[model samples]
Target: MKIGRNEKCWCNSGKKFKHCHYGRESEQAITKGELIGQSKNIRSRKCCYVPKALQHECDRRIVNAHTVSKSGSLIEIADSTNHVYGLKINLANIFKNKGKLVPEKIGVNQASTFKGFCSKHDKQLFSCIEDHPFNATEEQCLALMFRSVAKELYAKEGSLLSSEVIKSGDKGKQLADQLSIQKFAADNQLGIKAALRELSDFKDQLDGQLLGNFTNNLSHLIFESSRSMPVAVSSIVSPVSDFNGTIIQDLGDLNVVAEQIVFNSFSSDGKGYVVFSWLTKSAIILGFVNTLIAIDKAGIFGALIRLFFGLAENSFISPEWWDGLPDAQKKKIESLIMSGVNPFKFDPKGLLIDDGVNFSGWNIDNIRKINF
Candidate 1:
């Protein structure tokens, strides 16, 4: 199908084709500066919270709240300078690193932070886990997962809104190039839309629990480590397979809502913990969680490190710990982190499977569950 000369542009610029990409198709399209500026501007937009009711009590100014608390979690991994190496994967960094994901030193205050909450709401809603010690109680688990959900939703919304600017990359191309670019953009937008729907539903449930000081329709798995690993993370991932290489959900089918699980790692009160949280009805994720549980205690740390590197970019690592790793181990970890960023190197089935790496330096001392 061909767009008419006077029809709305395919790039969603809301301008007629003749006035937008008509004659300029043969010329260089949007510059890198414009694209970068527009993208940054889009992500910079802030909101109080997802629920409308809470907006009434929101502080006038939005703050960059840390998904992993600075005082409780990041401090455990920070070095003498109060800094950790966080995985930085953005347009600017990618270009600088030649399409590789590299770990860069980040101050504790800035690591794992997102502009998703107001000052008052950030402190008020997370007081249970932030102000108090982590005991894996219902409230603490709920708060941990809620913060991850909020940050993930904020990121997805930003990506969805960046479609127009992203599609403008096709401006300098021929008709064939334009069609190809627009088609890919269309498919990617569909996936993002589906994710937004699922995340919005989950966030609503969390809102109710946080507001009422109760938990319902939520399930979580807590893995306790008596020793703290020199790493901390907060992220939401939709795993397509379990550790045994069994398929869990077909992520290719955009019509079927993908199963998502919130995974966070942090250390508090002389112990490190890994927590998995999801809706009770998410049978797909429940099976995935069970697979995680079935892993022998000896291999749990390796499996988790793989998952964190393969699926999460919001993770941070201690500089001393990372620099101390052998060259082979560093390359292995870097490869896993790049799989999520570089599509050509991605292998979905290998994400959680045991590959005999046996990553060390952490142990699971106990396991606990709530309403699973």
Candidate 2:
């Protein structure tokens, strides 16, 4: 006869099956047998995104929702408007090829959807939040997109690690890196949360403020983009030699490096922001005071980095901005790209700077900044 989890042990030990023989049997079944239990409590799987205020009365009909909409192709360009662009990237390849100078091949696009909200909330509340990429004109949209990608990536990475532990019963080097990435992703989530809180708390005071603007006026950059790229791009770093053949495993490293190059346009005293898309391996950095100095700091990698920036700038800003730059600055950037020295070996101290960006327009110069 089959024994229930709460039933007494078949060995007549007067203990619950889960506490005795069944426990050992279950362990053995998981380790030695091919079949594993797939059952889960439906109620336990209910969505967590529902606000507590509305959750109590709502009939939670939970569904797996895509953090980034999956409707469009991974990369697309419209003939009608050359300015609009859409893109997505494979996150798995980025992790698998961590220290490599270049990815062996692009990874298959991974799903960003997860069970997070009920059908009602998913459509009414969550949908609006996820729509930031399309609707937002300022940097807040990037922050929202980053948070969404980071949250989903963290969940997926953890699930993969758990599956590996069950299948191979080993925690290897990959696991260590995965764990580190997971932790940083979690921290990124926290940073996003703090940013949101700051925004919400000071919304009344900072109306009509631009926290930051798009890199190339590519307001339509994410119009048709897949949801998978933000996390993928955020996790990748160039100059493969920087981390001793390992991509950045810490969020702090990512923030510092990105600020040094991509966000160089933002003021040194102001907040820094970065949004990367997988489609073209392009990034948009915001809130920098001077764009030229930032490009200079990229050194030998300036060419590749500038290429992506050029793509973004071309898409958004008018050609006048490019033409407006001093010829001397243009030559300097071109020279750095030609030099071809590994950026890591150059001025390492130049890369280190502020750790986080303020997405909220609230001036907290007098207040202690919140750390992610």
Candidate 3:
């Protein structure tokens, strides 16, 4: 029979279930190499990303949420089913090692996810955002995706801080300030919630008109072997910050808010640049720039920015230059441009390596291989 956390332990230890075997089941599951499914912790708290109007009802039934959707497939630099790339960076070790890189065998999984949202909001609100990336093309689609991810990241940070506040032994002004920060984060998330819901409705209207074209564009971008594509996409197994130490410091100055997604668009010397970055434990960065910039040059810049400034700024071949070209011709140019960049040149310490039988010329796949 099942037992409640507050009830006596089934083992008859004369202690509460929580203090006795409440969490042991999870521990055993982990030891046995099984996924724990989801968190068993439930509390009487409002859905963190729910709209203000629904706040009252949200508190009545809350569920553990996944920060990143589990459904989306991880974007791979090179697609080979038989070959798996192993990342030897341990994120938890970075903090314990006093900000030093400690390499360990951390298998990279495309399906990695974290828990933090209510079931109702997850299905109704965040699912659209999660699904957008696969077909994202226009700026509006990207904005909606970024905003939704940012809200989830900030909410997770606030939840962590709140837990710390509760666990702290001290009770004083400092504790009050911590609580205030947590509340501020929660408030910020609500604004994102309202914006995302509005965007979702707007996106629904555009879907009928834009989705077909967007899907066509995406297919051309992903499947065509041409080098002229104006964008680059790459995924890393560890936290983005662990790969770049300076980001931890640079991000601190952007704002007091936790884990902000940085999106920037600018033009320099007759070239356009677009950068979308989500600063999470695992990050997928999408970059679009003028095609004039060499892929290797752009890769170098991407690595340095992540290393020194936690950003990427590079010139791109102008879209106006190719505006009238046939769609077929344009796709070829885009493919060539994408093929030129070495996406994996930035790991200064050589932490990322490819172990699969087929090593596609993807820059990330060629970086120094570590045999941990």
Candidate 4:
């Protein structure tokens, strides 16, 4: 079980053992401040959306683009202080919350924002969804899906880039702890790499459509809420099960690139919209969508709340509504939300079913399906 000093590190860091983990236990542990700084540095490196044709059109300044529009969606749910509750996923915040992820009050301007696009392209590309009303048009749906996927792609790349900082926690730890941490990091990196490949492909397709000024091979389902919901979210999920507890895709299969679908929810024009968008002719996603439609109109909101907390992390909650929930209910929802993003958690079965918890009282007014 002994590794040669010149051999690759047991942690799979692609460095020799002597240069990577050898004598790591004797080193000083990475301070919390260091980890925070490293994370900030990673985030500070901006990424822009510049296709081959638009490279010359990109702006010099990279802006923090909102996946969920700030002017239209987030402002509708902001409290008196213009803030909303967002799940903080940093190591310091997680440790502060006793090793659990919790929703922290964040300014609406900062919530759901990512430095994923330049100012010029951000304005030009997302004008339909960002500047105007949402009527479930093909352009608007494509914009919605584009922003969701782009945000997710940026996030996954960040997580992958932060692996070294994460592995630094193994410093000054016992060999067993170091092994556990490194193994988890290695496994997580693999997952992120797989996700990045799929996201890059999807983004390329979206970029092609944007460049061609056409919408093709896109499908969407839009559910109109009779009233505004207290939450706004933009995320991508590879669904494993449906509302009926039937498995539609096996997310555990390492060889398969799991089917992904974009789920976005926001309030616009005095009503709420829950949108699901995906590529064309995906039987797996189609089945998943069918189960969602099969849910009774009365219970659709509850089903969506469960599914959102179970699978998505880019969800924001109105401070007023979240504060009104009972402590036990909030705890239950937090656990459900963490189950989706926590690397150590593995229970993905029956994530969309009713769990005897209802977080929304809004009713579905209409359901619209679009194929193009």
Candidate 5:
């Protein structure tokens, strides 16, 4: 909300404050009894139409989503234009120490898709134990194992992960010895396969330890990326501290990636929402959702959002009103909003109203009045 005196207006038209929406008339109209309360005749040029115009436009196009996550709760702020969304994933349930492989914790931190690459990563090392003999170069073989391990836990671009239920490593080993060393050599004909098999069960344990370290580093990078914005919820499913506390090189760069994501998310949201928010800066549209309604559906908003936010003309959304948008356009909107966010202030939390209720869920009680 705080902008510098000479800053490019967040409203984004390329003009200075003296010439933009906040021009002379706008500066004068904020006085007396006109700007704050609701009035049906607000569209008249002499009134508060200008400020309301921006808010209303933003509201009309902005997408409102509420998720009941296993972690906690999620509120996303996006429009056909801006992609900056905020999710408050709660982990209070997991830290209680009662459950195994906490879904809530993993979902909040990792946000994995449960698809392709993650599955393969898990099976990689085990597959190697089946194929290559022990005489192979442990380092390179380990790399293969690392990739496989990563795939199991991480989702890859393309591949089938086991849909069958997975067993805990400890419990699975106690019950089924499927994860083994000798089987690795029998399956692989590599030079070191046989030698690796001779290293004993204790060696596999060491390999597992090393694998944890490797995965931890990768997971850390993934986590920072997810939280820092441009808003592609991270694909990782666990927190980094779980990885035995290994320190990584270039931690600073990881944060940069986070900033990139955050910035992109906001910009995308601003642009996508422009579909609703961008009117004749002259119209008196106000409120977030109202902004969306103000859009002229024909091609004006679509053009501005696309040209400015890089959104396509069509995007796929299922709400009754959303049917008006095409899938490609929606995707483009998402991409543009994501690419234009601000990293330092990433993730668009819900707007700050003068204590308004956020309607969500089916029950009438879902509406909680706020006094703040």
Candidate 6:
């Protein structure tokens, strides 16, 4: 039987489900004792209590988003529109406690964000915040801020999004919501029509090329083909072995794919975001190379690094706001991509950034398989 993500792991490390005890469930949860000196906005109480051990199946537990501190405090996201919230965390604190963040690849799953994430000058949320309730962890603060700003942006349109719409339940879904497609381009300012064409074109092949023969004969491979480009555009899969919609296993790499997906989906103004992503990639590579050079650490990856940056500078990077990257970092990035070694096989050591994990072993893109 296939193992569900939420099921107890067969490895049995006394950790239940994923990394133990629905650990991933309440992503907003901070380690209990670690909250000792949290934020001044958070009050500590003698009544503080740790939760009891889990008894029932992890899936049976319900998530309570409105959790409060024993000191009678609740996290609040003041509606702020003038400011667009990016990752808001005290990185210095994290560096102090966790040591340096190990400088690695970082990518949000299905990592799409609004192309131009700026607020009207009058609506800036980045300004004015006396007391941050969360401490040390910028991610939590940033997430909270992103949600708050997003809500403010949505409110302007008079749309009342349900709380359920904000669940971190699926990164892909979250990325879709953030793009605000339906509203971002109600009249098509971001170019949604062209993006949808790819999907539509693929769908058309089934009807026009296959005729009715595909109605039952070839419906199964649609999702797989859409993501992986299929072995050949014309080939179809057996009906019994298809129809799964999951995509993207190596989330760090998703920084590219997700950005491409959303940028492609924009009805208008997308060219700007597309350009921005390439710039971002270029900047990362160049910056890394510069850091290495400063420390005299450049080794064999130099060529690959330069190639990655070069692609950003010379390749088809659409919009150019992202060109704001420093010149040195951009160069190294071009080198990485244009290097002789294949990116799929080079497997840069310690290549992680953010929570991205290695996907080198994935036989397919999503599910790990079994050879019985």
Error of 5 at 237 (Å): 15
TM-score against truth, every candidate: 0.94, 0.33, 0.33, 0.92, 0.16, 0.16
Q: What lDDT would each prediction earn against the true structure?
A: 0.84, 0.32, 0.32, 0.84, 0.24, 0.23
lDDT of 3 by residue, 252-337 (tens): 13232323233332221222233333322212222111111223432533332222122211112223233444666444333322
Q: Where's the lowest-lDDT run of ten residues in candidate 4?
A: 341-350
Candidate 2: residue pairs that collide: 216-316, 216-317, 217-316, 265-288, 265-289, 266-287, 266-288, 266-289, 267-288, 267-289
Q: Is 3 or 4 the stronger prediction by lDDT?
A: 4
Worst 10 residues of 3 by lDDT: 31-40
Candidate 5 residue-pair clash tally: 92
* Residue clash pairs of candidate 4: none
lDDT by residue for model 5 (151-177), tens: 222221111111110111112132123
lDDT of 6 by residue, 153-263 (tens): 222221212212222222233334433533433333223333233233333432232223332211110011012110000011001100121121232331332211000
Native-referenced Cα lDDT, model 6: 0.23
- Between candidates 4 and 5, the one scoring higher on lDDT is 4
TM-score of 1: 0.94
- Cα lDDT over the full model 5: 0.24
CA shift of 26, model 4, Å: 2.7
Give per-residue CA lDDT, model 2, range 241-311, as digits (tens): 22112232233343432211111111111222223222121232222212322333223123223332222
Model 1 residue 162 CA deviation (Å) reads 2.5
* Winner by TM-score: 1
- Model 6 residue runs over 4 Å out of place are 1-315, 339-345, 348-372
Worst 10 residues of 1 by lDDT: 87-96
